[model samples]
Target: MFFDKSHLVALGGNMPSAKGESVETLRAALDRIASSGCELLAVSRFYRTPCFPPGAGPDYVNAAARIACDAAPEAVLNLLHRVEAEFGRERVKRWGQRTLDLDLIGAGDAVLPDAATYQAWHDLAPDAQQSEAPDRLILPHPRMHERAFVLVPLADVAPEWRHPVLGRTVVEMRDALPDDALSEVVAL
Candidate 1:
């Protein structure tokens, strides 16, 4: 079955880009998304978030945007990567700082790479998770539920978008997080 649904994308960055500051880079990314054929729907307020690994680099500025488009999940992901490259993003380090990070958090209720594939990566041990990267895109982002940086901003733009596998709303996922989980994500 084919579906045309709005995709949710998470935007983040810590390193300055050709656009200047990280926050400006994120804003430029949103513009890129719109220009890539997706209708820019909503953008969450920018937040100051500490680096995921703590001290990997400068604190990142994060936000989320909802976009309506007919592109398939992989195509949308490819577009995101292209935008990242346009802004000077590099893959030198895992979870390392970058000029931009555009994560395709979810696409309506469509799950890419199948359920089993998503679960395998989703269930990976934490240590292994950091060291490994999937060969293909994982829909609904395998780890979207576990990170406050992703969820907090997601709640702003798509609180009601349900996860295809977890069946939980973005707000529910964010609310389920421990207070300490979101301690470092403060509004900018």
Candidate 2:
């Protein structure tokens, strides 16, 4: 614990079935976070969706979580990476697949200054596809409003979760969805 602040954390990924970290194995990840002294404020129900960055594989079960922690953003991110590794996450491809994906969705309206700092402080490597840095923690995520996988589950726990940037609610984004890229949520 370093600083008292409320934040939203989004979780996703297929959790490498072959390696054995399945979607249902979330308790272990949560335990790790708890060990780090983070307080669980809220957690979204799991939603299954077709894998994005599409390929031949099982679908992903995604969810969002709202947490309160006293840790610095970088420290919290470091802990998240450790959780992913503990769950056996492998970095073999660009969104190719994963065991667990933990993202620092929002940090009390804090901004990262630039993409390089954003990625570095979080120990994240940019996906060659993304071109620019964002201004804030980029919550409700920059693309979350447009991605059904993110919205459906996000809507479950935070239907009224407002995007600080776009100022739209999760439900609003889901209702405004135009394409079929995001399949409906499958209850787990």
- Which residue pairs in model 2 clash with each other? 2-70, 3-70
- Residue 102, model 2, lDDT: 83
The residue-by-residue lDDT of candidate 2 on 5-105, one tens digit each, is 76667787775533355555555576678788898777888778777666646688788777778877767777787888877777666566777888776
Evaluate residue 156 in candidate 2 and report its C-alpha lDDT on the 0 to 100 scale.
66
- Residue-level lDDT tens digits of model 1 in 76-99: 889999999999999888899899
Q: Pick the TM-score winner.
A: 1
lDDT of 1: 0.90
What is the TM-score (0 to 1) of candidate 2?
0.76
Local distance difference test, per candidate? 0.90, 0.66
Task: Output the TM-score of candidate 1.
Answer: 0.97
